[model samples]
Target: MMIKSLLRISTVKVLILLAGLMLMFAIACGGDDDSAGDSAAAPAAEKKAEPTVVPKKSVHEEAEKKDDSAASGAAATATVAAAKKDEPTATAAPVASSKYGGTLNWGTAPNNNHVFFQQYTPGAGAAWAMNIGDPLMAYGKGSEWLEAKSMAESFEVSPDGQTITFKLKKGVKLHDGTDYNAPLHKWNLDWVLNPDNAAVTRPQISAIDKVTAIDDYTLEVHTDRVYTPLLNALGMMGGMPFSREEYESKGEDHLKTYGSSSNGPFMIEEWIQGEKTVFAANPNYHQKDTYPYLDEIVWVEIADEQVRGAALETGQVDVADINSKSTDVIAALRNADDIFEAKGMAGVRLSHHNAARAPFDDIRVRQAAQMAIDRHAWNDILQGGEGHVYMGSVLPPTSAFAYKVDEYMYEYDPEAAKALLEEYAAEKGLTLPLTHMDAFKCTDEQLEIGCTDLEKREITVTVGKGAANAARAEFEAAAFNAVGFEVTMDIAAGKEGPRTFVTKESSFSLRGFGVRPHPAGSMDSYMGYGGYWNNGSYGTSDAQMELHETLKLAGQAFDYQEQVRLYKKCQQIYLEHALGGVKLANAPSYKFWTTDLRYDGYPDFTEVFFPSDTSLKMYGMYLER
Candidate 1:
């Protein structure tokens, strides 16, 4: 990814000098350090970067014009150069003026009533909540900073780091025409913290001791201890506040019976369950200047990816979420000139293992299981060589806290896997059931791949199948051998299924952790005793405990260098213990948007694309006249 930032010439000069000296030493000693050489030579290697020129025709047509390997290499080189330059070499088309009025037609998968408060998951529901409800804090689009000037004007952390004070944006009105004040904030917090609600956001704010309304617009949130990801967590689903009046008057089932009552830029005008949800601009929104350029936003449920793509192509829908499975759609959209744009961000796909169970409890068995499957082949088969192999770490290399340790990556070794499985079978004969949820189209294929390899190793593997929820339930009940699922740091950190697994209510399961903007948010959720995904009783080994401690220290450590060092240590510990389950492959989440949708502040299309947080805030989004 090309980061837009001014180049520091002085820093580059120093880097060049260091590189030159290293090259001299390497040549003098006749030493071969290809990786080291590449890193050192990167900065000084090029004075200017060449931009990747997307062909005017289809990708397939473009591929036919040039040598496939050569073109790919050039693109890779150009990408690295652009990243080093911290700027886009190609000139982007000028963004047109944002015009308000038209209804933005959006398509999404079925929500199954999870779009309501307290029950909403982080998938599609969180994305909807981001636009419908206001958060106390927000993350900057494609930026590392946490934006505090949203729902809350300012915030203060106590010197002890246990208390946080927030001043609400004055004059903000909820969808129900009630004033948004400190009491409302406290009310939302109380509801989430209430065990009766069983809110998924509970674990995210579990460290908070209490929330109190200091004044009409002032709120105080005190934590039991120093919670590191508190601010980031607040920027997520946990921070969204609902209308108190609607909840109280309409009753507990109001959200389900009626609709969303939020104080964001938009309010639910009408919701035809399973069909569509229509939202109109909130007239009394706090951020009046950016209240909403679109007069109405209609979110239609389109389960089929191909159908969603077709809708977007035919101008029936303005935006849709497309995955790797929608390869033809993605290619078609990418080929379309100014009509459509497809953007993808790398996320992890994993096969979760049950560390608490007998065969998986044995480290060798786990290693064999991981080694049996060829991740490269999986990527080729599933993603068409578009995915990157994810090592054990949840954080991508772009993150500051990411570790450079690759020794933990289990290489595809069928011989070693067969030997290990044979040894295990000789010791104790067992039939392992490989399970997968039917929701993910690739799950069956992924399981089959693993099962086929295991069968070759003389290991009996049975296929267990069911609906997504049913599979999850069966896995939680420990009725199967290994269950396959998709996971993210936020989901794992929540109080739902991942938390139950962490609590040792369920045994072994396979899952993936996608790449997150920040490492701590995801890492903390799966690391220590407090982690939502740490079955502390069953999976907490001595090494895992040490890793947890290291992560905790990293969270508290203010020094950037110290934090990196601690995170590195934690990664080492994780790899040593093989606590990250079995990592498979990471692929970019492909999302498409119509070119007609113009965003006010976001001049670049890439700025508004975030698949992880689903933070494509529609407040400032407008249609181009």
Candidate 2:
């Protein structure tokens, strides 16, 4: 009875949370208003059109709100030490004991949070909600998929495997004064399937049909379908329980500011919007003495990538974002008096194209795009040789399951691209006609004119199949022009920039450059042609669509042997016919982290201080001298 009362958070923000805001233009990015079943459900179309959202402030406005507007490294260190200033900090089940305290500040390229991600306040999103906040079952930095017990003292999975029960560690307290008890902390996965929550919850708990708590420390989860990675998901923000008092106070997009923790190793003491967010170590943090090596963290957001690079070089910031777009930054860091450091993760790019469209509406067109780009050259230039090129629809070949069969899409042939252009032209019927959006491949000056302008829509793409977006834009412009077809490459900015053409299906074809969630071994990633990512909306060759369910089920199979068998089958699916969006070169995921802040996953800073964290697990991370 006590548990139910505490857990009963009024459906205060539930209405606003009708769907997710993972995409920048969450409502605009989607196609339909009523299709809630799709993970990224479209917003109900507005009865009256709304004006575009213009940024009233700078990208780093929130970070600038802090006291340490210029340099934050010292303030960040003070954060860890600040945690000790509260209560003498303790060691418990989740966070193993260690006596390190200091604040760590970090930055994200897209340094802001949206509505769908309100509950998750980390830089990346809900994915890092664990250690910094709460992990129903935290992933001890070292363990892969195996959740390290945190707020949960110990746990047991039901014999049927659909349900998982957790034993709560005693005397757990939220960053707020409220204490955590069973029913309050307990939530049913079934809520995710509820018609009310269905559209919003589909992406997070697709495998979960129900959740129930038998006791305070024990939970029972029942799956309508076989769910193998449910535990891993539990170690994420989706599984982190919300505080009743804290959740209801924020306004409009208020949920995004629901800042209070139940069991993460660190506690965000204060968030000075546009300045710096201060994260004090959690005195009651389960990981005793081990947490938050520095004192209080003063996380500042610097919008200009160049400025961020400069900050790190001058020690104004400890770490910053790195990826294909930041080649110049990487070079500067490497050349910086050995003071700068960088690390990268390969095989991380996924191609997103509308399944129900022209150009991409044809599988051959999609294949041509995959083969047109000089992937290695792009990686060599942008990723600085740290990147890996992949034609297959999976991570890298390093994994046992990635389909390394016939190296199908590696041919960077413009000739072939030219041939595919003819097929599209022949099919679409060209009356010596050219139609295109003037927005794409345009300089900032050209975009002001808009895509529909009949006069300036055509462009001469000189860079033959450039790299990534540049390559894609050039190929699209070149392809259509070859056959006297018109082209449109919409380059909108803000959340809607890249997808401006895609949402409207206007570009020759678009690449949705975002990474969706999936454990390393899961083959059903958006990259792989699994259910939600089935390319049906973009363009699925008949052969590729047939393997949909096979890969989906194989993706969930906990049995290693069965999963391997299905993976082999799924790879064949892609090889037979290129899916609508073909895998180009995986953008190298980079992390330039400080050696002092210890944690898992190479410089993931969502939890290091406080901003937006979906899943945060602090382990093996202690401050160095």
CA lDDT of each prediction against the hidden true structure: 0.52, 0.42
lDDT of 2 by residue, 305-334 (tens): 677778776666665665446678766766
> Candidate 2 — which residues are off by over 4 angstroms?
1-99, 114-123, 126-128, 140-149, 188-204, 249-252, 258-262, 270-276, 338-342, 427-486, 497-545, 594-622
Candidate 1 local lDDT, 1-625, one digit each (tens): 1111322222232222222111111000000000110100001111234222111221111111111111111110101111112322233333443466779988876654645755664445555666787778665543233333357766666666677787778887788888888999899988887756767556667678899999999899998876655665676556788887888877767686566577777888878877898888887777656557678889888877778878888888887776564667677776655444534434355445445444555656666666666767766765667665655444433333333432434577656655665565556554333222111122354333221111111112211222332333332232112222122212222234432333332223334453333445556655654455443323444555666667677666544344445555565455544565655565545556665566644445444554233335565567765
Q: Highest TM-score, which number?
A: 1
Backbone clash total for model 2 is 80
